[model samples]
Target: MFLLEKLFGGKSSAKVNAIKMLPAAYAEMVGDAGHCQLKRLHPALGVFELHFSTANGEKYACQMTACVAGVDIVFAANNRSVLVSPPFSLAKLRPVFDIALADR
Candidate 1:
């Protein structure tokens, strides 16, 4: 089994758990309802878009890529973006950021 599947129950579970693991700050950015969601663009690509809730009407778009090296996270807003590596954990919960029953 893949590490994520073993750590989480399966691919579905991994995706849900990953969305649950979204940083609190990011979750807050997603807005109250309807605005927070995880969209899978392809097998290896996923997108997390959150409402900006600012006067400018800009939005926060987070992109996640599943790669051999691990998942790559990029947060883009207002034409600017920053790369964020998944947090390290001794426990088995690595990120499987994808769409599904995901809460992202």
Candidate 2:
């Protein structure tokens, strides 16, 4: 089992976790925008690259980290403000980021 699966649980792949966690974190950071894309960073270490466009034609990208507690979630983008209590049902995981761009 991957570290993410152990931490986040469910049948989530690393990429899927990246996608799901990204939106959650982004929502906390930028508010509801309806569309966004989060790229994965290799050697993930619970971190991801976030790219998002707001409804007002603004775009931003940043690095994000994910933290899962015993039913508690504290992500990097939220600055620990948006409290996310887990027992979350994960769906899938895939590689959304360009691994080639990941640092060695």
Candidate 3:
């Protein structure tokens, strides 16, 4: 639930590359359906969204917006009925960033 800049320095290429290397199962979980979800929620400007279903059938949605120094990420469950906003410094969110990279 952290921003990409906190771990990836706002490099879109790295993120895309990371996603391209995900395991097949995980990749499938975030396939076309998930891409549609993300597209539906992404802001016209500096925002990004992503959706995925877990192995147990639970679904998650993540929304992020670009900030001056970084991006702000919010995670939600149940189609965004529940939301959690977790702010991260540009160097403090590598794990989540890695997950995003793998999922993108």
Candidate 4:
């Protein structure tokens, strides 16, 4: 890994790829869950906890977890098992970010 980093300018390709894939991953994640607000649970850390209300007015939270392997967007209720884990294409990132941020 160190050798790969040294050859690749000190950053693992996996980490760079994952960072490049975040925004679209996040949009598809939040869009699939309907409307919701995302909050970074630990600002200094790389964790984000999403809060959204279900159709029945019940509240649920899901944490966005990312690592060198990849990013996992797990939708779960507080203190319970996972509700859903939607599949997304990492390659779709460029367009998503482009369209989503075109005005900005």
Candidate that scores best on lDDT: 2
Residue-level error in angstroms, candidate 2, position 36: 1.1
Report the number of backbone clashes for model 2. Answer: 4
Which scores higher on TM-score, 1 or 4? 4
For 5-64, candidate 4 gives per-residue lDDT tens digits of 332233344333443345446556656544445566332233455555544566655565
Q: Output the TM-score of candidate 3.
A: 0.31
Task: Judging by TM-score, tell me the better candidate of 1 and 2.
Answer: 2
- Over 1-104, each residue of candidate 1 has an lDDT whose tens digit, in order, gives 33533333445644434444454433444345323344543322333433222334544445544322245344333444434454533122222222211332
lDDT of all predictions = 0.38, 0.48, 0.38, 0.40
Query: What are the models' TM-scores?
Result: 0.31, 0.48, 0.31, 0.33
lDDT of 2 by residue, 6-47 (tens): 565543644334446545644554456534575775433666
Choose 1 or 4, whichever is better by lDDT.
Answer: 4
Q: 1-104, model 3: which lDDT tens digit per residue?
A: 56544454344533322322223334444444433134332222335555556555666555544333233333222233211123332223323334443433
Q: How accurate locally is residue 11 in candidate 1, as Cα lDDT from 0 to 100?
A: 52
Off by over 4 Å in 4: 1-33, 41-44, 70-104
Model 1 reaches what TM-score against the true structure? 0.31
Ranking by lDDT: 2, 4, 3, 1
